[model samples]
Every structure is written in structure tokens, then in C-alpha cells.
Target: MRRGFLWDGFDAGIAAALAGDPDTARDHFERVLGEDPLAPGMVDAQEKTRELHALAADREAVAARVVHSCRSKPGLDPVRLAMS
Candidate 1:
């Protein structure tokens, strides 16, 4: 397979894993690993895949909390948000 194909497959795997499809994600990730065993991005992709899997496994604990702090109610600091 082409390098771009592997890259796209890896991207899709991350998306699938985040969307709660571990089987498909694992298959795609394995394919990516087979395609480029020594690629620099393999480690990062593997780590992110595992993270997404863990997040999917415990989605309830990863709920988003709306922090209503002392900031302005109507607007956010664009610079601060960008930095974050």
C-alpha cells in the first residue's frame, strides 16, 4: 500500500476508536503497523489508539464539565482559549 493509504488508514482508525469501534480500529491499526513497522509516527499512533480505546471504555467518567468561573458570560478570551 501507498504511504498516503497507510496515513489515511491510521487517521480513520483513530476516528473509529474514538467513536467506539475497537474491532475496526484495531484492524486498521494493525494494518498500519504492518505497512510501516519502523515509521516515526507509529509510536504516536499506537499510543493515541490505546488512549482512545481507554476513553471509549469509560466514557461516563470523561464527561465534560461546564466550569462557570469568573470569566465573562457572553464571551471568552480568544487568546487564552487558543493557548489552551
Candidate 2:
């Protein structure tokens, strides 16, 4: 039997988020929310996806800052950050 379930979108969002594809995850989560914005749990999932994307962006920003810091500082290598 074929099914058109809302949770499918939610689950796909989680999987994409875990795979480091927050934009895809948000797209999925938003699709579910779009179906029923007032549905129980759907709102939460939407918020969670938004937060996850924000966090991912923040992490990338921090990493960029670290890389830039390493480049600007004298003889400080970001690769050494891994050794420490």
C-alpha cells in the first residue's frame, strides 16, 4: 500500500542533518511544516531545523576564523591544532 505520511519528511530531515546537509534538512522539515503548520511536533521540527542550520553556520564561521587566525599569526599553523 502506498502512503503519504508526514513523518517521512521529518525523518528525511533528521538523516540529512546527520549527514551535514542542514539546508536539505531544513527544506524537508519545512515541507512537513508546510503541509500542516499547526500540527503537533511539526512546529518543533521546523524550529529544530532552523536552530541546527544556524549552529552549522556558526561552526563554519568559527572554523574560518581559526584558519584566518592561523594565516595571520606568525608561524601558527591550524594543522598543529589537531596535534594539540
Candidate 3:
């Protein structure tokens, strides 16, 4: 099912994040959010999928904020931001 595909992406994202590969995790999470055929005929499944996508988006926003903060701070190691 389409919903299963979305869930697989979400799971992969979580695994990538836990493994410290933010780029890959972001890719998977974005795929989950982009796939729109998750629950073709079920409103409840669609709503749940939307909620999960929102959670992923919130996590993404937080990560972006952290990266931005790290990038703007003076004297911090550039390696922390993978800049060098």
C-alpha cells in the first residue's frame, strides 16, 4: 500500500538520523512528506499520515535552527557544522 511506503520512508529517516547522517535522513523525511497517495480512500489514515509528516517537519525545523545557530556563532569549530 501507499501508506506502507510512506511509513518505510519515515522509518528510514529515523534510522538515518540516529546514525548521524542528517543528509540521508532529511532525504527520507522529505520523501515521506512529498508522497501524497498514502491513504487513497481512508480519511483517518490520511490524517495520521499528515500528523506524522508534521512531526517530521518540526524536527527538520529544529535541526535547521540548530545548524543556523552553529553557523552564526563566532569562534566555534567549523567542523561541527561540517564546513571544513
Candidate 4:
């Protein structure tokens, strides 16, 4: 399930970011992007994670934004929300 994989990667990325590991977060976000670049918040998550990795600033806020984007994308599947 591509959607499931994206969710997993996104979740892992958020966890990594919250743990103050931007490199790992970027890696997970990039993996999600690889799976589905156009999937909802994939691009934003990847870009934000990349910035977090490079700038190393405000990681918690970045992670929170990533989680919000992933959860709040318009027209997202209700089933996917349940899955997460």
C-alpha cells in the first residue's frame, strides 16, 4: 500500500525530528518523497525536513508543521486518517 508506506515514512520522519535528529528525519521524508512525490504533504515535508537538516533551527516547530500538513491536506482519505 503506497499510502501506508507514505504514512509510515512520514510518521518516522516526525518522530526523528521530534527526537532532534534532523538527518534521520530528512532520510525518512526523502524516502516518502521517493515513494510518492505528489502524495499530499510529501513535498512540503521533504522540503521542511531538508531545511531542518540544513539550518538545524526550530526542529519541534518544523516537525509539528510537517505533522499538521500531513494530517490536514484537503480531500485526504478518511481511511488514511484512521490508518495514521
Name the candidate that leads on lDDT.
4
* Model 4 spans > 4 angstroms off: 1-4, 37-57, 63-84
Ranking by lDDT: 4, 2, 3, 1
Predicted candidate 2 versus true structure: per-residue lDDT over 3-67, tens digit per residue: 34666876676566556677776677567656645566666655654554454434354344435
Question: In model 1, which runs have C-alpha deviations exceeding 4 angstroms?
Answer: 1-4, 37-84
TM-score winner? 4
For 17-71, candidate 1 gives per-residue lDDT tens digits of: 5566767766776666656446667776556445444444332321211111223
RMSD of model 2, in Å? 11.7
Q: Between the candidate structures 1 and 4, which one is better when assessed by lDDT?
A: 4
lDDT of 2 at 45: 55
Screening candidate 2 with a backbone cut-off below 3 angstroms (N, C-alpha, C), the clashing residue pairs are: none
lDDT by candidate, in order shown: 0.51, 0.56, 0.54, 0.61
Candidate 4: residue 82 Cα off by (Å):
28
lDDT of 3 by residue, 13-68 (tens): 65665456767767776677666654564444345434544444455543444455
lDDT of 4 by residue, 1-84 (tens): 256467677677767777778778777766765664666566666666465555334465665555565566775543322221
